[model samples]
Target chain A: MFVHGLATNPGWDWPTFFQFFATRTIFSALWVTVQLTVYGTVLGFVLGAVLASMRLSSSPFLQVVAWGYIWAFRSIPLIVQLLFWFNIAYLYKELSIGVPFGPEFVHFSTNNLFGPLGAAVLGLALHQAAYAAEIIRGGIISVDAGQLEAAAALGIPRIRQFFRIVLPQAMRSILPNGANEVISLFKGTSIVSVMAIPELFYQVQVIYGRNSRVVPLLMVATVWYIVLTTLLSIVQYYVERRFARGTAR
Target chain B: MIDVKGVHKSFGDLEVLKGIDLDVPAGAVTVILGPSGSGKSTLLRSINHLEKVDRGLVRIDGELIGYKRRGNKLHELREREILRQRSQVGFVFQTFNLFGHLTVLQNVVEAPVSAQGRKRSEVEPYARELLERVGVGDKADVYPRQLSGGQQQRVAIARALALKPKVLLFDEPTSALDPELVGEVLDVIKELARDGATMVVVTHEIGFAREIADTVVFIDGGRIVESGPPREVLDNPVHERTRAFISKVL
Candidate 1:
């Protein structure tokens, strides 16, 4: 360990690395990164599933609305969306839940309604949802039409049929692509630094700005991302295996 | 008991069934034989509302299959109601569309326990009994992919029987199986016929139809060309179209 430390000690950058690790700030920042990823992915998945269902619905209005959501979100850059949501106070001074174009039952200042963390999660999740929706839609569509026909002929309720038969099979196709989105989202969390959220990357930037150990502190953030993504990849493998049960090779 | 009247079905520009009419009484086996693309399958699918008729009605046990008759209008049943109606009429497909992710037993017990709202414990034994009767009892715990074509088809039969429907429809059940495995599935159908289950079968197998059919209906160009007792239709077809089709197959 002494020899390795000696070999790696370039301009005493190791001290900054050690200092960053020893402080509670780095760990808290790491927590923020995890929170954003987990919540973003989960919320994104729910919205994506709903959007995919809408896209597949018989109603033309729903199909168009779903299509517009996906097209708009996916077409806009993630950074632009983050900025737009973070500065949403400019567009609407107050957020309210009440009748449209009528009296407001309740209201709150937009700036107070959403903080930086909320804005980051909202931007990341909504953006991820657009891509996730298509992935899920493709998966649902890829299932054999015969399966639906069979389920219908068997008299299984439509909702039950989708959950029991269709979704299970669809998972076989959805998992691989869904895993891609999750891993991408994990790394994508780094972009939240723009909002001054003080997540891992942002914290690293703050530490290096004070200490001037730029490259090494950046490496610290890089290593953490690689480690987290590697662990996530391992999880993806097992999840795919579980969903692939009873399916033909 | 199933009744089909003036059932017309068209796809795009091609009319598949041009006003078909037939009646299948309780405990009778009606075997429909026809050449490919002759709309025999379409006719079979219409009975259970899998294929809606453009102009006509299908009645099962004195109830309209997929519509609620109100006064002078027939409103299409909602999905939930249609599902409830379908649970009482079992169907077996040619390709054996068993749920691949489910085990044989799960496939059989699914419709009964979920759609029919029966308890799992209550349905399990009968599901196993159906599997045993279909000759796939030992394979119930296995996935559909792990089973042979014949085994999968038998599992499908068991699945349909689990619903305890008043009538069962088979659409070329053996056509998708290998020749060597065909008899296994045919044997199960033969046993069902002997038990006097009401069945409507659309198939190309002349021999199997001859052995089990109470009435053999021949279809050509989306119309029933000839229909009668097995011997009369199979051995001595009067219509030239039926004769030509039988001649080609035999």
Candidate 2:
């Protein structure tokens, strides 16, 4: 119904575009992308910090296991990780969901996490956790020996010592790198479209299908990506500033 | 107030301290004087169990410093228990190991607030007064790096005194300070001596030792070669090692 740059490209249609982007479907896709970024990064960071602590374990066995997990997950591409989980259900006939060796039992139909929204979340979160663990470990080790010794010398309880003294200081050192990880993770969610989870990229595809103007539709998706990344970066700077007090000295 | 008996220490095969014994009476200044490898700092550190002992025992406030009983056998105290015992005697390090991330006030209040379970409300005022006593009250809110070496060491002393310790240990406290700034920190130690808190100090300052110390001990090659009143030991010299050490410092 509308034409954009009519003189330059007589076929460049643009009138329905303003109304097209404002449609509920496009808006819902934007919200889904936001949810993925929020939940995925949170779950990933929590699991990653714990794993990083375990990775620094004194036992060789735990170290080997952690090393193996990081190597196996990180070396493969995220697209491959998603596909492997999606297809793995076909390989295994039975899906047993029960408390192992704990007198509890439940069973599920063989539905491996693939193609489903939950599977996308699970795949992204677990894969991100591997990289997040290394980031957290680097932050923790960057704190000086004197700070930990000073905390221990004060006789704070071991758990309290970590949260209050160790973690705050480590957060200051870790946050710049952590913010970058968050941004990368946000973009990484786009890979989920390959599995058909109906995210932002999927919505963009639907628009292009109705009116096959591929470049402009892709441009709309690119604009949303830039806006989201810019907003996240602003939040990151403030969060980093809050934690970095007294670190200057 | 403190007793170190037949204390032996080794860093693997190095044998940093050997069968050292000494008595520190309550409310008197004891200055330990020795050459670079004389184990002077090691002796001062052992009194507070900062440097763990290989054999023998240290007793402070009549409680054994390092050894604990386990099914009728003695074992080194656990970390938690070690902290409780060590808190009674505060140590000042040569390098002024002030927590760089904390302000002077936080550094002073840390041990009392966490180690002793004393309220910040009760400890903060006393810390401020102690900072005034050491003559660095103005530097209270400043971080350690912002202060001069002398000012930092004075803050270190204020930090030590914040706990109201029974005996204060100084391990070459002024050794790392510039020559001019040394007097400011030493002057505070001299005042602490006048107040009669049980004090054990290791120093390269012959003049500070001669002025404030009640007993002067000379150590060489991991043993106490001689000990007596500062006048007797520093002035008269009982052994060739003591004579040579004092002659060079004097």
Candidate 3:
């Protein structure tokens, strides 16, 4: 009865859903979502790797700095962080590149430089970095100390040891958790809708608001998210297999 | 070719080695035997600079290990330099520390290629030869986890030999192996000894030491209680502590 009602009901608007699904506006909005996810993941993981190394370093100052960053970012909600970045112009008039406490070399007006999209990406990356840092550190520490000792005893260069010996082993532990964070971030990109960036979720809201076809428009966005997330999961599977080279039974 | 002079090491308040002085001539097999917590491993590790000495010097072929001698002071070598020095001194642990991510052949080839800067093409054939020598040639493409404990230990030995190290240090290489698997690893080490490799081994195997060791040094309470030819130290221990320890192990 539910399937028959949905198929027959005029409110289902299957024709309108099909018409708008392949439209240029919705496709462009999806492109925006893709950009956000890609930029957020790449930048977040890069910063996270640096933070993880800092946390693992012998220097107390680096450890404290990494701890403070993770603490502060994690404490703030992602939406609140995004809102703050969106209104950063109110907090600071200009961002600059210069020596500390010295004359500015170049400056960019905050309002002009960080538009809605830039603010969303920046907010997502910074928020994602905190979680990524912990994941990476957990992976590194999960590797046995004996592996490193063996590498060092063999006189492998320190850099080579980290890349060849430590990283491969760490990835075996890191992949599942890292993939979780990425999938979360991909879905989390929808939160940028509040900043008025026309990503997939915001675009769907816009179409339903105009045409009053809420359920069908919502279904379109849901299907796209499922398809993309499935692709990401497939990629994660292959990457995990690559790192799990030796330990497989 | 290995010289350890007045080496003293402590971990916090526990002094592991108390001014150890020993010398192993070129091409000699020196076996260190001691009860647990007596610092036999510490002394063996000190020879390779795995455990840095709080006081004293270790030299392999007259080059100070882990330090460069300056004007009356010892400056610790940078990591790169220390690594280059370490490439000359191979160490095998009680736990067969094979690179688990790498295949048996890759584990053997990694150090010689990456650490010593040998060509992979050249190292590959030589690595297979070393694997064959160690009796793991058939398992070359397999990971360390796929092999038995005895096979893994043999691959580790092959890895150490790939570097053509001046001295090889074994810290209870067979201690972690099953009783049934111990002989295979021991036979390999005995062969290395017969080939006149300069090796310092720390083991509880009294029979193996007597058969393979040129010098047997028995340590007790962070000091060498007795050391001489294998028969003298094993059969006719001069010190009462050595006699007691030997009797227990025998």
Q: Identify the leading candidate in terms of lDDT.
A: 3
What range of 10 consecutive residues in model 1 chain B has the weakest lDDT sum? Answer: B236-245
> What ranking of all candidate models by DockQ puts the best one first?
1, 3, 2
For residue A20, model 3's alpha carbon misses the true position, in angstroms, by: 2.5
Question: Using lDDT as the measure, what is the rank order of every candidate, best first?
Answer: 3, 1, 2
Please identify model 1 stretches exceeding 4 Å from their true place: A1-12
DockQ of predicted candidate 3: 0.82
In the range A1-249, model 1's lDDT, one tens digit per residue, is: 887875676854776677676468888999999999999999999999999999999999999999999999999999999999999999999888999899999989999988999999999999999999999999999999999999999999888999999999999989989989998999899898999998999999998898789977887888788889999989988988888878876
After best superposition, candidate 1 residue B83: deviation in angstroms? 0.8
Candidate 3 C-alpha lDDT tens digits along B158-226: 999999999999999999999999999999999999999999999999999999999999998898888
TM-score of each: 0.97, 0.85, 0.97
Error of 1 at B72 (Å): 1.3
Clashing pairs in 1: none
Per-residue accuracy of model 1 over B130-239 as CA lDDT, tens digit each: 99999988998989999999999999999999999999999999999999999999999999999999999998899999999999999888888989999999999899
DockQ-based CAPRI category assigned to the predicted complex of candidate 3: high
Candidate 2: which docking quality band? acceptable
